[model samples]
Target: MAKYLLLKHYRGAPAAVNDVPMDRWTPEELAAHVRYMNDFAARLEETGELVEHQALRPEGTFVRGDGEGRPPVTDGPFAETKDLIAGWTVIDVDSYERALELAGELSAAPGAGGEPINEWLEVRPFLTCLPTVIE
Candidate 1:
């Protein structure tokens, strides 16, 4: 099985059909969206395809080592100035097509008015370290 990453972007993506921000969504709609995401992950686990998933906080900083004896330099969260990644899921699937199918299902997650969001997801394959043997 190959591993693929499904990336959900908060910015730097095409506007979604249901483009209302999560903060603007009604409480009920937010709850339903959360439930749908959880259920999707659970279903993937049941199918033995889920490797891991995570949600990131909007606030983050960029840090760099200044020097061997100096403190690291820190920068602003800069969410407005940069494209923010909201979350991701790693899946081990039998084929690339399977990964695409799973990503499509995830992109169909419910949004406001209990309608499909039609969100865009970036799918990328992981490079394996295993050596290939040429016949």
Candidate 2:
């Protein structure tokens, strides 16, 4: 099965949304959301399709090489970047269509009021090199 990456891109600015993002959500709503994701992941696991899944921290540093002796310079999380990725999930599927279907299901993750967040996800296939990618 080919692997795909389901990227989570946050649309709004973190600061502008509220002083606290998830904290702003009601306790019941948050629990429901968590349950939804848990159920979704469980379903995928039962299908033997989920290879691995994880969430990532938003903060990151970009390093640029200067010289052999000089240490690489670092940059921060750009506040102005429009499409800031919150996290990602990896799954193994048979084809691109199947990957898309999985991505669709993930996008339907529960939002407030038990409605689908309908979040945008970037679905990209993993590049395999075992069989000579160049050939």
Candidate 3:
């Protein structure tokens, strides 16, 4: 089976069909959205397609290694960055078509007004190591 990553972005994507910001959504709407995602994951898990899923906090720190014997450098939470990832799901499927279909369905998760967000999800395929050629 091939593995694919479904990236859910908080920004840096085109506006969703619903277009309403999550901060503007009502509490009930937020609950419903969470429920939809959970239900979707459960179904995928039952099918053995879901490998793992997780949600992330909106903020994150950027860390990089300094030269040896130096402390690692840390940057701000990147609030000003154009792209912010909100969550991710890894799926193992038989074909790319299946992966795309699943991503489309996930992008349909409910948003404000109890409507489909119709957002875009970034699909990335896992790379396999090439066979080594020995002389």
Compared with the true structure, all predictions reach lDDT values of: 0.92, 0.77, 0.91
Q: List the pairs of residues colliding in candidate 3.
A: none
Clashes of each: 0, 0, 0
Return the top candidate by TM-score: 1
Whole-model alpha-carbon lDDT for candidate 2:
0.77
In model 3, the runs with Cα more than 4 Å from the true position are 129-135
Reference-based TM-score, model 1: 0.93
- Each prediction's TM-score versus the true structure: 0.93, 0.82, 0.89
Task: Give stretches of model 1 more than 4 Å off.
Answer: none
TM value for model 2: 0.82
Residue 123 miss distance in model 3 (angstroms): 0.4
- After TM-score superposition, the amount by which residue 24's alpha carbon in candidate 3 deviates from its true location, in angstroms, is 1.6
TM-score, cand. 3 vs. native: 0.89
Q: Please provide, for model 3 over 24-63, each residue's C-alpha lDDT reduced to its tens digit, 9 standing for 90 to 100.
A: 9999999999999999999999999999999998887889
